[model samples]
Target: MKTVFITGSSRGLGLEFTKQYLEKGYLVIASCRTPEKAKALHDLKMQYSDTLSLIQLDVTKEKERDRAFDEINEVFDSIDILINNAGIISGDGKNLYNLGDVHKEDFMKVLEINSLAPLLMSEKFLPLLEKVTNAKIINMTSQNGSITQRTQGGKYSYCTSKAALNMITKILSNDLREKEITVLAIQPGWIQTDMGGVNAPLKPAEPISKIIELVETKEIADTGKFLTQEGKELPW
Candidate 1:
């Protein structure tokens, strides 16, 4: 059976992805910042039983990251897919910032969480990822990352961080091109969630299911290209 490791598997899109992967019969290494505090993930662990394993990963914390790396390295020698779903948007609703008022602290934190964390995780998991016969890296990016999609730009922190993440995805695809791995930059789209908020047009599962389909497909010429959930090329 294919094994997948997903970060930020506590709630929202992460939780949903974990559920779907388990339903599809894949062994899921689901991670949350706080395994004991994540009631939902804890419950899913109980429901899925042995199919799902819960672990704590703050992503921002180096010690936690190291512990997670060591534990996964010891437990699972290979991971078929690694989903970098852990991300943050600092100024979503509160502390409204215009172009001039973009708080430095918030911007730095967003970049650290959304952009740097994934790279760190990938680096740590390289050995485990390489052990798999056909490994894939999925960077959970956003349409906001696309310069073409930026019409009304306000959330500077989120937009900049996600856009940087898009670049990182492309870079990963290029770096791993010679390797037997597929690195994809996927836009989950504007789905209703804590980040997307309610009244968003698309459902959370729509983009997620699309991601699963894209990951399983054969590698095409567009290795480092950015794409939407529907497999359409997104202008970066």
Candidate 2:
């Protein structure tokens, strides 16, 4: 069975990804910042005990990243897929804000979690990812990242962070091309999740299912593209 590692799997899209991948017979390593508090993830772990491995991970912390890598590497020889799904929107970016009123620390925090952590995780796990023949690194990005599609002005911190993530996806895809690891920045649409909000028209399940399909079917030739959940290529 293929092995997949997912960050932020305590809730939202990450938890859903863990559940579905386990159903598909993949050995899933689901990590969250607080595993003791993740009731939903615990429930899924109980149901899929044999295939699911739960670990505590705080994507922003380098120490935690190294520890998690050591733990996972000891048990799993290789990872066929690594999903960089952890992210955050700062309070200053939660809604429309005056440019001058946005908190500098909060903005930096958002960038650290939403942009830098994924690239760091990819770097730390590249060795394990390289062990598998058809390896992939899926960066959970947003269409808000698209420089060409920017029409609105608010959400400065969130938008710019995602844009940085888009650049990381492109660079990593280029760097890993010879290793046969396909890298993709997937826009999962505005789904009904904690991050996406309740008013979102798209549900998490449909978009996630479609995303898995794209992940499974996409060839190396399709790497480095920013794609929608529906498989449409978006403007970078």
Consecutive 10-residue window with the lowest summed lDDT within model 1:
89-98
TM-score of each: 0.94, 0.97
Q: List runs of model 1 lying over 4 Å from the truth.
A: 91-97, 218-222
What tens-digit string does per-residue lDDT give for candidate 1 at 126-196?
Answer: 88888876688888888878887899958788888889988888888778777767788888888887877
Residue 33 in candidate 1 has what lDDT?
A: 88
Candidate 1 residue pairs in backbone clash? none
Candidate 2, lDDT over the whole model: 0.92
User: How far is 136's C-alpha from truth in model 1 (Å)?
Assistant: 0.8
Instruction: Count clashes in each candidate, considering only residues at least 3 apart in sequence or on different chains.
Output: 0, 0
For every candidate, C-alpha RMSD to the true structure in Å: 1.7, 1.3
Against the true structure, whose lDDT is highest? 2
